[model samples]
Target chain A: MIERALKTGGVPIASMLKRGEVKILVVEDDKFLREILVGKLEKEGYTVFEASNWNVAQKHIQGDRPHVILLDIVLPGIDGFEVLSTLKRNRETSAIPIIIISNLGSREDVDRALRLGAKSFMIKAHHTPQEIVDAVKKTLEEYYLRR
Target chain B: MKLRVHGTLFAKFFWTLTALGTIPMAISTLFLYATYESRIRHIVDEDVARELQLNSGIQFLLIFLFVLIMATFAAYIISRNISRPLFVLTEVMKRIAGGNLNIQIRVRRQDEIGDLGNFVNEMVRRVKEARERQEEISAVKSEFISVAAHQLRTPLSIEKWAYNLLLDGDVGKVTPKQRELLEKAVMANESMIRLVHNLLDAARIEEGKFGYTFQKMDFVPFLKKLLQDRTVLLREKKINLVVQHPLPRDLFLTADEERLSIAIGNIVDNAIRYTASGGLVEISVDTAPPWVTVAVRDTGIGITKEDKDRLFTKFYRGSNVMHIATEGTGLGLFLAKNIVIAHGGEIWFRSRETEGTTFFIKLPLEFSPKSPSVVSHDSFVGSI
Candidate 1:
């Protein structure tokens, strides 16, 4: 069903979000999952950045400003919750919309992530790679359209 | 745990009986004294009557002695009647607290003590049921390592995505051999998805999400069709699958066909799974008044005593047959047991090591007739 949504109406929205101008930072710990997400996001014409751990994620966020961030809760060094709080605390990254794509499916975790200023929460297991790409596209459109 | 006695049963019984015996005796003794006083007044002069009054004092003392003796006897009998059962009840309670749920105090009377015994029995049953529920939840939690949906599902999602990418030829044009290898990968990925899906269903079943859709239907045809489908497995193993009885002409039942099918299917699958090549499997149905019993007997490697004890426990693969067949997720029989139990039925098995095994499922003709919902369909992993 999500695939149908992406196929029917995703292209125009992808163009409208200015795929070339948009930058998305994916903060995930798993190497294989990172590659899959990167491949999907890059295919959608967005400038995608990757961070495998908390230190790299911190460095990347401080040096480069991305319009949106796809954050995962489980990480190698400092966990995703800490990363979420750090980014939300900073003035520059606080305005950037974060969509959590993690395997933490409990209601408590989802509520906590949303309360910590995430734009959306998607369970990694429930969605296809393309659907996640569509989420990024939709979040960007909503972010820009609001301004 | 300390047992709390609500009221003093022995004291209550002793006091009630003593009062019953003494009250009448006191009244009768007073009447005899009154009659004796009148007769003495008529028969004697004033001086003689005074002496007669002294004699009547002896009669009063004798009556008091008799009443005391009778009250003591009655109190002993009454207190014994209550105290014996109470002693037995206390012992039974101690046994229960020590984790023996099968003991029941013999109820012999229609008194309060009998009611207490019955109440204790009911309490033990409820405790046993609650313990079973707790066991299932903990088993499911441990099986998935606390995050069931996330653990298997994330890997399945990644595999499916990767397989889809390969099929789409996004990376490069695939050669013929590469396409064949990718197709195998797709098949393997699908099986992994199915396995994860089954695990999710088992978790849902543990979580008490049995979506049953009960309907009135003929059960004989359903059983026949189910067995007919199993012919493939039977032939592959060269096993003789026998139906012991002709389909009952009047076998109508009210059941959730899908869930019941899955439950029975799991048993039949086990029968096929454990049976050696060229073995025998028999299916039979018999009626014992209000219940219908379905038995699946297989002349295969039977369950060991240790395995039988843990058969219904979740994710419990038998230690004896671990090397025999290693593909099972150990959730099939657990799911079947719960499904049968939820349908107001009973499931058990009889087995002798190295001989054979027979599983029995008993279902009542009438059960909870509440309208069934379709929500449980999502709990199933593969196609029904």
Candidate 2:
């Protein structure tokens, strides 16, 4: 799934993928935005899961153990920073490539997220849905290459 | 308030006068009286005694005058010593009140006046600290604005993506009229994204966070891709975008490609935005030893004489263009100049009102082999 996308300019929609494998968990708070993102990712032929808050995100993270995590910084409880630090600390989930989709665009925040082991940081309003999908695919490709 | 003396100058003056005048007069008069007392009785004659008394009286008069002169001199010296430091303290207060915080009183005494001097110094320091705290708070506020601009982009990004989907027919195919309306919305969304991005960038540049990543890259592909990206704008405006220089197959330049793209893109975009329909914008380059100069000349409604001086100033929209284009935030040229200078380059422009404008960006042929940092270390020409 990842290799095909990487070969074709990293367009997630163009690359065919297996349904059960290559799971992506999206953790976002805004219901409309979460649905839009979920719709975009599902259209790209990937198995997707949604978590509206950090607690739900944690349950999905520990139980499903998704391949890639599309995380948002601002959440209802225990924001993205805390969630990021927690996942990165765990032995099982540490290898999962997490990309931060956040409204926190300050240099300090970006540097902090990157330093905490996020694969990439995306400003929510700055990127289109398709671009975000591409970012997910590119990050997945890079993660596999590193492994 | 009435003058209250901590240490009395009057007392010093009185003591000086008593010591120099009264004491000396009493001693001299007693000695003179003692020497004449025995001789006056022995003489016994009335005339001789009276003559001797007169002589003693004249001597006393001379001694009194001498004592008075010495006393006045001593009083003057004592009074000056007491008042000189007070005069110095008054001058120091005047300076501190006039916003000079650097001066400190010379606390040479351990008396009440010395304590007063130290008190003044402490007050000045507190004032200075308060001013510094005010400055720090303002800095934090500006930093907050920058961070807020970043946060503002998220919603804008969502809107942008949503609109783009509709325009691309991701949801469903639409009629020609609906497509045109959706396209307008897409353009508006794009403008918002650009604005938010520019605001964040300008704030970062102001706070010295916008840095450079130097890499060895071919300039030919970079410029080609940069211009090709803006083909839509050229098509929409029907402007003839010309590349004057035939780019070599391999034109290598040591620079930061991302920042250079923004800088050059801003210039070309501005050219397209301001120029009327069917105008010309030409991009050319000149290569010489140690310098590679890129020039962008636009046949736009050129800058006015008044606006030319402040063209690159942040948030300074030209009066002429304000009616023509209300979309600009006036940060593009300012940011472009900073990025170019950050790469050890210079940006200069020449324009005539209603004629045209030509902006030239000159970068060094070589860069420092190490990481090239930002250009906000010193105040630049574009800074307001």
Candidate 3:
């Protein structure tokens, strides 16, 4: 049934199978944006996990490591920078490609995100859901190619 | 205020000099007279002694008058020297208090007065440093505004995406009526987004954090692409956009493409917005050696007399266009001006109240390497 949905979505079957094996963890506090991102990613045939905060994100990371992480800068308990550094410092989670999806579009913020080991930075408002999904796919492709 | 201090200093010096000169001279004169009277009384007869004594008294009177005059003159000279620099220093301090931080006291003397001059210079330096520090703190405050604007854009983006998704039939097929309302909502959301972006850009420009990347580009294609992007707006308004290049060759210039586009785009957008439907916006490029000029002429409601002086000021909207286009943030032209100037170019306009407005942007064909992509905040402050 999932394959049929993927096929109807117009993605090639082989690529869909490969994408289905890839897990993406979304770390966003805003419920609506997170839902949209998750829906878009799932429709693109990727296994999606949602985390509203760093702790939840940590749990998802330990249980079943995601192939890619979509991180947001603002959070309730711990901020995105700390989460990014923690992920980068740890040997296991460091390899996973992290794409920052946030509304903080200042040059300084973008520079800081890139400097902290994010694979890509997308201004949440500046990009549509499809564009963001494309970014994820691009980051995943680059990650796999490098491996 | 000036006279009292001057008088006090003069009086103090005068009395001190007078006392020092007069008291010693008077006492010595009394001793010399006593000795001379005794000697003359012993040496000569009464008539001779009397004549000599009168002569000596006259001589003493003359010397005393000369000493008094000399003291007064020396005191006047010394006091004037001391008070003149003090006067200059006081004036400079008042100017500094009035918010002029560029003044520096020139010290010529090696005396205490010169030391005071040096101190005043040091004080001005410290004040300038403090002002810069305060400006930096305010820059941080503007950064806060930038962040707040970004936060505001987040939800707006969500609305934009959700509405777009519905319109595109991603979630379900949208009916024509539903699509029309959604389109209106999307346009409103997009305008809100534009306002937020403009606010963020204004904040960045103020803080001198608006980054630019310069590259050599062909001006014609760049301009053509920009006009192509405005097709929808042009079609909607039924405005005629005519591009004219008097020169047959392509105009080449070094610029930060994105920034220059915004600057030029602002003029074009303003022309379209202010002009009536079926009006003409003519964009023409003319080149003289080492200089390229782009003139945007519009058949629109021109600038009013009152708004003429403040056309490039932030948050300035023309009184005539306020009712016509209420959504203007008044930052477009201001940002456009700054961007153009940062490129080492000039922007100006000619307008009459009822006829039309024509904006001219003059740029150098060769971008000087001395002024890099990022313009200094001091330069911006001076421009305003």
What is the C-alpha lDDT profile of model 1 across B1-384, one tens digit per residue?
774434556456556665676577667667766776777678769777766666666766786677567766776677677677777777766666666665555566777877887787788779979987988877768456446655776677778778667766767888889989988887676666555655766766655544666677788898988899898878989999988977567777778887788789889888888889989999999987688999999987889987888998888887766888766778888888888987789999999877788999998877776554433222111110
Residue-wise lDDT of candidate 2 within B1-384, one digit each (tens)? 787444567556856686767676678777767766776657578777667767877877787777677766776677666677777777766666665666666577787777887787788779879977986886686688677776667667667777867866778988899988878887787787778778888877876778677899899789989999999989999999999858656668889898899999999998899899999999998888688888999999999888988888888888899999888989999999999988889998988878788999998878774464332322111100
Q: lDDT winner between 2 and 3, please give it.
A: 3
Q: After superposing candidate 3 on the true structure, give the runs of residues whose Cα lies further than 4 Å from its correct spot.
A: A1-15, A77-96, A115-119, A138-147, B1-144, B246-252, B369-384
Q: After aligning candidate 3 to the native by TM-score, how far in Å is the CA of B71 from where it should be?
A: 22
lDDT score, candidate 3, position A129? 85
Task: State each model's CA lDDT, in order.
Answer: 0.76, 0.80, 0.84
Candidate 2 on A34-146: residue-level lDDT in tens? 88888888887778899998888889988887879999988875767888988899998998999999877766788789999999898877677788898987876676543
Clash pairs for candidate 1: B211-B376
| lDDT for each residue of candidate 3 in B269-359, tens digit (9 for 90 to 100) | 9999999999999988888868988999999999999999999999899999999988788999999999999888999999997789999
iRMSD, per candidate, in listed order:
3.8, 2.4, 1.5
Ranking by lDDT: 3, 2, 1
Model 2: lDDT equals 0.80
A-chain TM-score of every model: 0.85, 0.85, 0.86
Candidate 3 on A38-129: residue-level lDDT in tens? 99889888899999988898899999788889999878877778888888989998988899988777767887888989998988777888
TM-score head-to-head 1 vs 3, winner? 3
